[model samples]
Target: MIELVRPHAALVEAWNEAHREWGPGLHEDGFGIGAEDDVDTIEGIQAWIARTQQESGELWWIVEDGEVLGGIALRSADDERVHRFGHIGYGIRPSARGRGVATWALGEVLRHARSSGINPVLAFCAETNAGSIATLEHHGAELEAVEQRGDTRVRRYAISY
Candidate 1:
């Protein structure tokens, strides 16, 4: 089953365990973890998540089957530069790939955004991430632009109600 949940600092342990990957993509084509140079410890992820919730009212959900298989963040309230271009982000634990979990969770977030008065939501992913790109389009997100974050590339998609 899927859910939209708020993660606490305590869940940092789970986030750390769940995020154990070379990166956060379902496909093995060319997906790599973002911000490789940055700290990826549970403490760091917790701090980042805390700030995201405090500043943007974003929430986290565990996409799991009794385990934290993957997670998604509802970032409607995020209007910072990163969010201004792409207000939402999500990832599936490598073990849970190709199961339609991402599609369901993203759809739920979009519905959450609409009901919560967050118009014109943004969803960004790597340009080469066809699975993520397909998921966004499947849920009605339009490709607004493709951008490069230094050497890394990103595709920005938007859905407006």
Candidate 2:
């Protein structure tokens, strides 16, 4: 069974394994990993985990049977960054893709959003990401707009609870 849990040290090895599967990049969405964050060492991992407790947002790891599969985050709507990136961000490990994990994880996050009074949730994805687009649509998200952000065309979606 899939479960969303807070980042913890006990699962550091599993998390790193999943991270390695993604190779080197700062694009692991839902991890709340900034360019300044280094999750390679124990200290760095603990530091990143501690930072997740801050007010910016909440990050959860997608796990099943003690294995870290992915991560999903619900960003505070009040956050200024939400204006450009939207309220939700997520990414599944390449090995964990095509298993309805994103779809299920998104639903769970939306439930949390509803309880937090976020009302309508906004999500954005690359226009070329068919998997992400499908996941959002599966949750009844409607396209709000497609805007150009840097070199990528982003598709914005709004999901109402």
> Each prediction's Cα RMSD?
4.7, 0.9
Q: Kindly list the per-residue Cα lDDT of model 2 for residues 1-161, writing each as its tens digit.
A: 99999999999999999999999989888888888998889999999999888757788999999999999999987888787777899999999999999999999999899988886899999999999999999999999999998899999999996
TM-score of each: 0.74, 0.97
Candidate 1 per-residue C-alpha lDDT over 50-129 given as tens digits, one digit per residue, 9 for 90 to 100: 55556553556563544655666665454564463456677776777788878887887787788878778877889888
Weakest ten-residue segment in model 1 by summed lDDT: 28-37
Which residue window of length 10 is worst by lDDT in model 2? Answer: 50-59
Best by lDDT: 2
Off by over 4 Å in 2: none
Q: What are the per-model numbers of colliding residue pairs? A: 1, 0
Provide the overall lDDT of each model, using Cα atoms, as 2-decimal numbers: 0.65, 0.92
